[model samples]
Target chain A: MDNSDFKGKNILIVGLGLMGCSFADAFRDLYPQKIYGFDINKEITNYAQQKGLIDEGLTKINSAILGECDFVMICLYLDDAVQFICKNMDGFKKGCIITDIVGVKRKIVSSVQEVLRDDIDYIPGHPMAGKERQGFGYADKKIFKGKNYILTPTKFNKSDNVDYLEKIIKAIGFENVVYTDPEKHDEKIAFTSQLCHVIASSMVDINVDDDISNYEGGSFQDMTRIAMINSKMWSELFIANKDKLVNVLDNFLTSIESFKMLIEKEDPKLIDKLDIIKKSRESL
Target chain B: MDNSDFKGKNILIVGLGLMGCSFADAFRDLYPQKIYGFDINKEITNYAQQKGLIDEGLTKINSAILGECDFVMICLYLDDAVQFICKNMDGFKKGCIITDIVGVKRKIVSSVQEVLRDDIDYIPGHPMAGKERQGFGYADKKIFKGKNYILTPTKFNKSDNVDYLEKIIKAIGFENVVYTDPEKHDEKIAFTSQLCHVIASSMVDINVDDDISNYEGGSFQDMTRIAMINSKMWSELFIANKDKLVNVLDNFLTSIESFKMLIEKEDPKLIDKLDIIKKSRESL
Candidate 1:
C-alpha cells in the first residue's frame, strides 16, 4: 500500500483499451519497474505504446509475454478473459494474484476461475467510473480519483489476493474501497449500472422517429449521451448479468406502473412521490 | 411584431412565475409600451416590481386589471388557466386576443372558448423551453432565445390573432415558431414532454434506495436532473393531460418490455437490435 510496495513490481495489463490503458497510466506513474500490456488489436497496442501508457506492448498474450509479470490484470472482454486465462494459465507466475477490470462480478469470477491455474487467485474488481468516450486517447489518470471501487472475492479466493487488489486500487487514487458478496454486487450493479444504460438507450430509441430530434436541447442530449455506447460490450454485460438485471428491470417497470396509475387517476400524489425521490437524490 | 405595432398596446401576463416573468422581461424590453402582470402570490409580484419586469403588478385580475391589456397570456397551471380565464373574462377588453402557456390543448381551448365573449379570440401556445428551476428569481430574459415555441390553435380561433402571437414570439428572439392543431399538439407533447418527466422521475425513484445511493455518478444525475422539478406544478400538468400522458406511458412501458426481452435472451443477436437503435439515434 506504500511507494515501497509498488517499487520494482512487474504488472501485466491485458487488453490495452481505455480501461486497460488507464490502469497502466495510473500504475506507471506510481510504480518503479515494468508495466507490460497486451491487446489482440495491434492499433490499440501501438496507440498505447506511442502514448507511453505502457512500458512494453505485445499484439498477443504469448507465454513469454505473460510470464514476465509478477501480477496480471485481465482487461479483456468477458469471453476473451476466459479464453486468455485458459490458454495462458500455465505461463502466469506461480504465486501471482490476478485481478480484472470487468464491470460485472458473478460471471467474471466464475469464468476466469474455471480457467486459471490453481496456484493463481482470480480476484474480481470493478472501478465504477468511466467516460462516454473510449480507447486510450480518452484515458484519464484522474478517473478513479475519489471514486468507489468494489472487490468481490469468492470463498475459493485467497484472502491475501483481496488485500493485494485493494492495495493496488487504493494506490491508483480510489478514495473508497469495499467488499461485497458476488450476488449482492451484481444485484446492486444491475440497478445502478446496467439498468442505467438500458434506460438511456431506450430513451434515444424512442425519440428516433421524432423530426424535432435534430434540434434536441441539452436535456434530451443529456438523457441519451450514452446511447452511443459499444452495444457489443454492453449486450454481453446485460446477458452475463441477466437474472439480477431482470429483477432491477422489474422494479423499474413497477415504478412506471405506479406513475401510470397516478396519471390515470389525475392524482396529486405523484408530485409528492417525485419530491421524495428528488430529496433522496440530493442527499446522495 | 414591430416597435410601432407594440406602441401603446397593453399586454397582460398571468402567473408571473419564471416562464411568465421571462416573457414579461423580453416583452418589456422589446415592446416597452405596456406590460401588465398578475399573480396569486403577491410576493412574486412585489419581487417583479423590484426588478421592473412589469408595467403593473396586481394580486388579482379584475375588470380594471384585465381591461387595460390588449393581449392576455395565461401562464397559470393547465387546471387553473380555464378557471382563471372564466373568473376574469369580464375584465378582458372585448376585442383582445388571449393565449396561454399550458401544455394540454383540447380542454384549454374548449374551456376558454366556452367562457369568453364572441369578440375575444382564445389561442393556446406552449413554448418548448424553461429550466427545472422555477419562479421569478430563476427567470431570465434569454430563456426562450433560440428555442422552439409551439402555438396550438383551435379551428374557431382567428388566424389574425395567431399571426399576432407568432410575431410577438419571433420578436422576443424565438427562432422557430410552429403552429399545430390542438389534439395533435397534446399527443405530440404526450410523447415529448409529459412522458419525459414521467420516465425521469420514475427512473430516479426506482434506482435511489437507502443502501447505495451515495455511490451515484454523473449518469444517474444526468438521467434524473428533471426529477428535481416542481412536483406540484408537474403533477397538475400530468393530470390535466391525463389521456395523452397515459397513452405515452403505455407506449414507454411497451418499449421497456422490449428491453426486458432483449436482456433476457442475452443472445448475441440482440446486440444487432441495440446497434440498429444506436445507429437510428446517430442518424438523428
Candidate 2:
C-alpha cells in the first residue's frame, strides 16, 4: 500500500446528507483529490456539486465510478447503508478501504463483515459530533474539529487499513481518535448519547400540556434543548442498539426510582444522593 | 395602607443568602427606603451591608428594626423559613405584607398562615430564577430580569397584599408575575423545575464511571449543567414537595418506560414519540 500520498486518490461519499457532505467539505482541502458524492435525494447531490463540496455527483450508482475510488464513505441510515454496501460490494475496487459515520457500530460492523470481500477493508467509524438539525444546508467542515472519533474494527480489518483511516480522520481535524471494540462502543454510547436523548424527549413529552413558558428556568431549558431531535434518524439508531439502550434506560429508571423513594420517605439520604451526583459531575 | 410613596418605609430581608441579597440588590435602586438584612450567618449580613446591598445589617433579630419594616422578604430553606417566621411573627409591624422566595409554596404557605398574625399579611412568592452556585457571592440584581415570578397566594391572602407583593416583584425587574394557588404552583414546579434537577442528577449518577469528556457533546453538557447543585437546598425542596415531585417522577418514568417498550419491540411508534417531544420543545 502506498502510504506516502493520497493527493491523486479518488474518494466516493455515499449519502450526501449532513454527515456525508461534512466529510466531503472537511476532506476537500486535505486530500487534494477528486471527491464524488451520491445521495438518494437528487437535489442534495446537485447541491453538493454546485457548492463544490464534491467533484462529481452520482445521479445513479455506477460500478465504474465506484470501482475507480480508492476510498468509500457510507453515511446513510443503518439499513440503507448496510443494503447499499451489500448490493454494491462488487463495485468496490480491490483493497479499497470503506468507512462509515453511523451512531451505532456493532450491527453495522457485523453486517459489513458478513458480506465483505477478503480484499476490501470495512472500518466502522463514528464521530461524536452532530446538531439537532439535519440536511446538507447545515453541513460544515468544522463539525469534526476537536471532536472524538471512534473506530471499531473487526478481525477482518488490516492494520494498514486502520492506520490509513486514522490518518484521514486526523487530516479532517479530529483531535481524539479512540479505538474500541464494537460492543464496548455500543454500550458506552447507550449511556452517553442515546440515554440523554431519551431523557430529554421524555421530559419534553410530559411538559407539553403545561404552560411552561411562564415558569421554566435555565434548568428546564438545558434539560430539553435536545428534545428537538431528528425522529427518523434517532428511531433507527435506537432500534439498532436496542439491547444496550434498553439496559441503560432500565438502570436510569432505577436511579430515578431511588430518588423518588427518598423523596417519598422524606429521607435525609436525599442529600447524600445529591452530593454524590454533584461530586460525580465535578469529576467530569 | 398608603400605596403612593414607599420612600419612608423600611424593608427587612431575612436570610442574606443568594436570593435575599439578590432581592436587596435589585430593589435598592427601585425602592427609596432603608433595606435592612438579617441572617443567621452574621458575616453574610455584615457583607451585605458593607456591599450596600442592604442599608442596615441586623446582628440579631431585633423587634425594633423588624417592627419598623413595611415589607419583609424571607429567603431561607423551607423548614428554616417557616421556623423563622413563626418565631418572629410578633416582631413584624402591623399591616406589613410578608413574602418568600422558596421553591415549594404549599408547605410554606400553610406554615405561615397557621402562625401569621391577623395584622400582617403573608403572600407566597417564588422567583423562577437561579444558578447552580449558591450564597450571596453569586447574587446578581439581573437574575430576576425577565424571569417568571410566581405568587401562590391562598384565599387567606388579602387582595391588596397580593397586589403589593406583585409591585415589589415588578420593582425587582420581573416581567411576568403570575398568580396561582399553592397546589397548582407545587404541581407545575414539580414538572418544570424540580423534576429537571432530578433527571440531571440521575443522568450524572449513571455516567460517573464513564470518561465522558472524550465523547460528550452539547447535549450532555446541557443535560448535566444542573447536576452541580446545592445538595442541602435541593434535598429540602424535593422533600417538602415530595408528593408532587413523586407524582411527576412517576409520570416521567412511565414516559421513559414507553420509550423503552417501543425500543424493545422495535416499533415505528418511537418516531412518533420523538416528533411529539420535538414539537413540544419548539413550543417553548
Candidate 3:
C-alpha cells in the first residue's frame, strides 16, 4: 500500500490516554478520515470523542468494530502492551500494519509477534516526545513537531507495511524518522531515556528533605525538570526493561565512582577525564 | 552605609573567572562607576579590564590604591579565599566591608574572618548565578537577572554593611535576596550544587562513547549539562570543603542505594516515595 491507501482509511487508537488521544487527534487532523478510540475508562474515551480527538469511543474492542479499521495503534503501558495485542488479535483486519508507542521495543515486539499470525505484520515505533504532565488535557498537537520517530521493523515485516507506517508518522508532523533494529533501539533508549529518568529521580531524592524553596537556581531546576514524571508509569517501564536499564546503570555508577575517587584523591588528572566527557557533551 | 553609599564608592572584584567576571559586568553596568579587579593570572585581570568588565585590573594589591576602595568583593577559589584575604589584609581600608562570592562559606568563613581586623566587616555572600561557559568573553550583563542572591553574614558583620551588600546585589538585578547562617549555607549548597555536579559528571561519563548526536533528547542533555563544569576548579572546591561535600555525598549515595533497592524489588510501593520527592521538586 502507498500513501494514498491511508487517504480514506479508518484508524483505531487503543487506550484513549495521553498518547492514545494524541495519536487520534494527529491522524484525524492530517489523514482526512475517521479515527476511532478504545479505552478502559469510558469517561476518557467519551471526552476524547467530544473533543474531536477521535470519531468513535468504545469501551471494548470488538471484532465487528475493529474489522472496519485499516490500522490499529496500541498506546498502552509497557507491560500491558503484549496482553492488549493478544486479546485483540481478531479485531484487526487482514494485512493491516500494527504499530505501538511503547518506549522499549525489544520484549513487546517479540511478545506481540508470538501471539499474532504471520499474515498480520507488526512494526514497532516509538515517538521520542512527551511531557511531565499526562492525560488528554496535556496532550499536545506539537509534541512530535520536531521530534525523532524511530521505526523498529523486523525482516519478517513487509516493505509495504513499513512504508505505510512511515507515511502515517510523517503525516503526523514528526521531523525525523529512523529505521533501527529493536535491540539497538532499546540500547539507545537505555542510555538516553531510562538513564536520564534514574539520574533525575536520584537527584530529586537527594534533596528530598532539604528546605530549598529559595536557594535552588536554574541548574537545579533544569536538571530535575523531568522529576515530575509519573513514577508509577516510570517504575513499571523501568522494570519491564530491566536488563538494559541495569546495564546502563552499571556504566553510570562506574563513571560516578571514578569521579568520586578523583575528588577524594584531589587529583588534577580528573580534569582530563572531565574534558573528554565535556567535549562529547558539547558536541551532542 | 546605606544604599546611597554605592553611588561613588570604588569596588574591587578579587577574581575574574566566569562568576567573577559576570559579577563585574553586572555591577559595572549598574553602578556606572569604577570597578577594580585582581587575579593571580595577569591575563584574566587584563582581559577583564580590556572587556570593560572592570575599570582597574592589577596583578598586585597595593595598600595605598586598595585603601581608597570602599568595598572589596572577594570572588576566588574556596581554598584560596582565606589566603587571599590574609595576603591582601594590609591593602584594604580600615572600615571596608569584605564580601565573597564563594560557594562553601562554612568551610572558610571563620578562616577569612581570622585574617581580617575587627574594623573590617566580613559578610559571606554567594550569588546563585553563572553559566557553564567560563571566562570574561562569555560573561553576560544579565547573569544575575531574576536570580537569587544569598548573603550568609555573621553576627559580627555590621547591619549597615549587610544592608549595603544587599542593595548592591539587588541593584545588579537579583530578584530575591536571602540571609542565612554560614554553616546552613554550606549544607544547602552541598545538596544543591556539589552533589548535582558529581551526579552530572558521572552520568555523562557513562555514555561518553555513545553516538548520542542522533538519539539524545532534551532529558539527556539536561541531565548532563553541568558535566561541563571545570573539573580543576570543582576538584579544588570539593577538597576545600571536603567535610561538607563528603557528608552530602554520603547522603546522596544513600538515596541512590534506596533507588537501587526499589529497582531490585520492583516494588510498586516505591512510587509513593517517588511521588513525595516529585511533589517536593515541583514546589522548589
DockQ, all candidates in order: 0.43, 0.66, 0.58
| Tens digit of per-residue lDDT, candidate 1, span A1-284 | 23325577788888877788888888887764788889888888888888888877888667776766777888887778777777887899877778886777787677666776777777777788777766778888698798888888877788766776787788888878878867888888887778878877777666635575423335666677777777778888888899989988898899999999977887778878988977766665
List the candidate numbers ranked by DockQ, top first. Answer: 2, 3, 1
Which ranges of candidate 3 are over 4 A from the true structure? A4-6, A208-210, B40-47
lDDT of each: 0.78, 0.86, 0.79
Candidate with the greatest TM-score versus the true structure? 3
Q: Per-residue lDDT of A1-284 in model 2, one digit per residue for the tens?
A: 44533688899999988888998898887665799899878888889999999989997899899999988999898888999999998999998989988898888888878898999988898888877778899999888888889998888889988987888788788888898988989888898889999998988877745577777776777777788888998999999999999999998999999999989988898898899889888777
Compute the lDDT for candidate 2: 0.86
Q: Each candidate's TM vs. the true structure? A: 0.87, 0.91, 0.94
**Best first by lDDT, ranked:** 2, 3, 1
Error of 3 at B75 (Å): 2.2
**Fnat score for model 2:** 0.84
Model 2, span B1-284: residue lDDT tens: 43533577788888888888988888787654798898878888889988999988886898888888888889888999999899999889998888888998888888788887888888888899887778999999898888899888777778877876777677778889988888988988998889989988988877746577666555777788888999999999998888889989989999999999999999998898798779878877
CA RMSD of all predictions? 3.5, 2.9, 2.3
lDDT of 2 at A93: 94
Off by over 4 Å in 1: A4-7, A25-28, A94-97, A113-122, A133-147, A153-178, A206-208, A214-218, A267-272, B3-9, B94-97, B115-121, B154-175
Cα lDDT tens digits, model 3, A1-56, are 67633577878888877788777767766664678888889899889988888888
